[model samples]
Target: MSTTTPETKTVLVIGATGKQGRAFIRSLLFPSANSTPSSPTTTTYPKSENWHILAVTRDASAPPARALLEEAKSHNAASKVTLVEASLNTPSTLRAVFESHPNIYSVFVVLAYPGLGAPVTSQREKEQGTMIADLAVEFGVKLFVYSSTIPIGPDANDGIDESRKQKREVEHYIEDLGKKNPNWKWIVIRPGFFYENLEGVFGAIGTTMYRDGLKRDTTIAMVASEDLGRVVAGLLQNPEPYINKFLCVTSGPVTMREVLNAHVRATGKPMPAVPGFVGWILLKINKGAKDLVKEAEINHANRISGKLPTFEEEVERAKSVCELQTYEQWKRALVSGEAGGDGELARRGSTDGKRMSTSSWNNLSLMKLLAGRS
Candidate 1:
């Protein structure tokens, strides 16, 4: 295991126990971090050269936190990882994290959704995101990386979701902070649709709905959590070229048919999807699902009609920073247990192991949302 000397730079990762945070930690600590530079022009860097991670979580001793520590230990990175008990809702503790770690060179901010034990409001989400950005400036951190959601492409801004609007406000705040402080530097990465959204019971519902409901041949932009981490690590390693930039971190686009076909190719079994009528009924009856359907419909229409801008340029940029995997590549890795966090799918025929449990299901306000209760 590596030791944190005075020269070692630290990084404070918010939402450290969640999928996105875990992916970032793995990219920082794991020896075989997933990064495939797609072109000869893309630049690449070695993994976890001389870095320490302050893995921030609400509970330092929780199973997921413990699992992260254990994974790092197995990779000879135990000394490089530290579990920090903190919450974004509590600004004092968040400040304490920066105050305590003077050598922290970068901060990775990925705020939680559905609030902390409350419904997710745009105001609450924006408050939490901007608070962290403000804290980073106050602490004089060199780089601030915020993982944001997808942008509303080629459309009137007001047509987007409220939560999305709040995130954009946070991005604006970061940019404003940079302009006001000449010495400040930051990068905003807006990851496309998540592949993990196709993993468990919720995935079952969502995948089935999309597959059966959306028009055939309509493609959607997607990214793997593993790849998102690599992209962040690259920017952290080399922040000069991308200062104040927004990277669309994605593995290009894939259609619903292609997504299902990839699953069959990897596992030799068809994906579990509900019938068309059932999916249509759920979309009509469930408010949350209905909203999801509405969003998908807009995206699908844009994609099919050539109104959706291509993500080809974004994928190429990501390659220059880190190696990226296509959806098929990720699916193959997932089946062979080669991909990071592939166990849930490999062992159980379902992904999102952490989210499949009864307690986990109940804890997520998002899960309640899928059930039309939130």
Candidate 2:
């Protein structure tokens, strides 16, 4: 096992290349850091601190991982970040990581979902999550922060979705670990739908809004990934009150119409809208498509249930830890093409283009299976 000084705090981040993982890494590297200036600064950074990140990825040579390393190097923070190659499915690799880094102060875990070349089953998610928690317990880690989705309903079995069920189970496993070891600190962050989902930036599932008709004036609870990052960073810095607490986080309950309007205003082009009939037909024919619709409906219900934290409340809490952007602020960045550049938009648009043709054929096959149309 590697040795560490008392001033050093090591954090292990799982799924470091994905959206949530990248957000956590950004927060750790530069708390409340942003790509653009003129963004309000709400949190202060220590000039010299002893926080280290063990960023885990299946491929350390991938573009995203390399880009992260490059960015850290540019900022002169290279020594603080380490890119380690490992997969959650392989217990031996994970064991090696834990063994090599005996001074892991905390772990930020975001369980994998199906997409982006990653075949993650609900069973695999539970097993991997539990394995990590078990290791943390065995190592006597100080804190564990888990990023999870908001439960669809109050009851454990309220939703019929297997993924939701798996999340709850993993949460229970972590909570049980904390209970068994009173010294271990655990925090669960249940974030709402990500803004990137609506922007078609996320792979595979980004087409859901278009498939669901993108109805105008319909509101959904959403949070910017960066904002969520800020919240996590804040919690890490001031973890006393958040110990064993579950935070339901959201940035805005913005309307779909507003999102479309923002695009039109930004790009000077009207957004495309799929017909409701077409969407319904697709949903009936494709199980995956139908699940997407069901997930949206469940989230809409949860938003109106008045059980979640308000945008203002969440913003205030996040501000206490780091600066965050509102929906309008994030939308403006997209519109102005100031976030990542045209390359980002082009990539998302390309995914949307492929989704249209592939999803149609998939839906048609299911339709034939059901209607005997073949």
Candidate 3:
């Protein structure tokens, strides 16, 4: 864990509705509001005057997002977090949010604006990257914790995955921010795929797959959302000397078989069998194959060695962290589609059973996962 002087500071976080932002927000406000505001000279607008937080969001009125804001306010965090319009297409919209507050100590850019038109490009990245850094510089905010992703290179034998492709532009610009400026605290956290995306499998709902009684295989390297939240919280709470650096955080990775067994232990069920075409057929009979095909490819990659976690350990930890029922305590929970509720559990949100939020799945602040100092 990194270290930062403890004090009440204002924070400006972009993409607050997404998983990463939500985690970041919850973590910041959850335990306490010990945040620092940015300096005056470094940011586009001075954010060192007072403690005023602004959250950038695409649609402030969306139910789930609105619910989050309502929760924040209910928690007496009305003075801590506020939702403001920040669209990916318009960089100024985002800039306006951070600039809106002259007292922001830290600015967590959760998403980048679509530069020009391409999915990933330095034009958009550099512009916003520079703007974010400039705001930090102008505001005197010592920390500029932008969320980033891992460039799927060497460690990622997966042939420069899609995320890497999108990251090309962001990586260069942010690296430039680190090199050229070198003063503001800039870091990235490049994490692996999240575990929350795994609950919607055919087996979870009870449709078995049988190809000559030989089940298909599903592999995965998944990260826990709370872990993601925790590290972000920990780093922000204590960014010691790691500021202005990039590092990775993961509990470790494992396979579907391992994961299912743990889930079974929690739910008191038989080990889930990985299904084949029959499962796909069952899916087609019920939901559809578009998702199944993608799952198959993901499973294939996991089986081949994707960055997943040790299923057994994750389940054990989840039992404690997620308050999962012991086998006897889980039957009804599983059937009712309500395994975890309250107690830091992932909330039920849109995007089908995605335990985490949207920003994570669609790639929010991959930088925070990739290069966070404190």
Candidate 4:
């Protein structure tokens, strides 16, 4: 299954400073991040003899990036790899990253899409995605992994429109680039909606829509980010046979009620009501919200499943490294009498693009990855 050699392969990891990106790099850079790192050459920090990771960040000089460099250096792994500056906004910066590294073997795009509401974000992603794919082809990089979301389109009955439009646009853009650039292998990972989204929503409602009041029957697919990262990492070593194909991945299916139950376990609190009918009627007043509400209504109390992993199975993958618990784990964190047992609630502490230190979050991983495990 191993496509490359153990002699040494360089992984140019973009988004190396963010949540999923850091999770992946830290997994590669730190042996402690793994449940076991007894590899022969890496009795110290992981050696380049196996796999070296070139962690790239927008601000290579930033504190997080510096911390990473220092960590790699302290562990003696710095000599095995380098940290370069790159940005999607600036292709020149990204081009320099490729030019400086002749041995660049792969590209992992982990940043989020710009538009949560605007179509422009998706449009820009289509542009940047193709650009990255093209660069990989030009530089002779062996493989490129572009993280994506499940094609969670609007209701099957709603007909082809915006949801389907953006998903297809982004998917096709990278894929088309791969088609033209025969040298570069493309892996499009269509990850299901993240369970991470639930923690915050649950935190807000006091009671999850799953609390039997709101989205009782609404079904959604969820996966832990760590799981997605691991699968991508492992696949980089052994890719699926299908190229330019989209994967519908999820931990498992569960009702909003079930999620709420899990959240209450951690918070020891009831899920809140998602505004009553009046709230929905008010929300429906917005034209933009009309489709969203209709989509929600269609999924209400409906069952959905995927060929992807189950919730328990997905968590198991992220297990031993981090507490990849279902909502229920939230209960345990809360009940463990572990003070400051906040989960996604941390996302709420943002202001002007800044919040609490990310170090705290990374350090809190369930299966701790340490400095020299690999």
Best by TM-score: 1
Every model's TM-score: 0.86, 0.78, 0.61, 0.67
lDDT string, candidate 3, 92-195, tens digits: 77556656666666777665423111234344544555566666666667677766553333233333233344444554566776676666676566554554
User: Poorest 10 consecutive residues of model 1 by lDDT?
Assistant: 33-42
Model 3 — which ten-residue stretch has the worst lDDT? 34-43
lDDT of 4 by residue, 168-249 (tens): 5656777777778766687766565454444332223222222333355666655555445555655555554535555544
Better of 1 and 4 by TM-score: 1
What's the true lDDT of residue 105 in model 1? Answer: 89
Rank all candidate structures by their TM-score, best first, as comma-separated numbers: 1, 2, 4, 3
The list of candidate 2 runs beyond 4 A from truth reads 1-6, 31-35, 38-40, 45-48, 116-122, 200-218, 265-268, 272-281, 302-323, 340-374
The prediction achieving the highest lDDT against the true structure is 1
Clash count in backbone of candidate 4: 30
In terms of lDDT, model 1 sits at 0.71
Give residue 232's lDDT in candidate 4 (0 to 100). 61
In candidate 1, stretches whose alpha carbon ends up further than 4 angstroms from where it belongs are 1-6, 33-43, 46-49, 115-122, 154-160, 300-312, 342-371
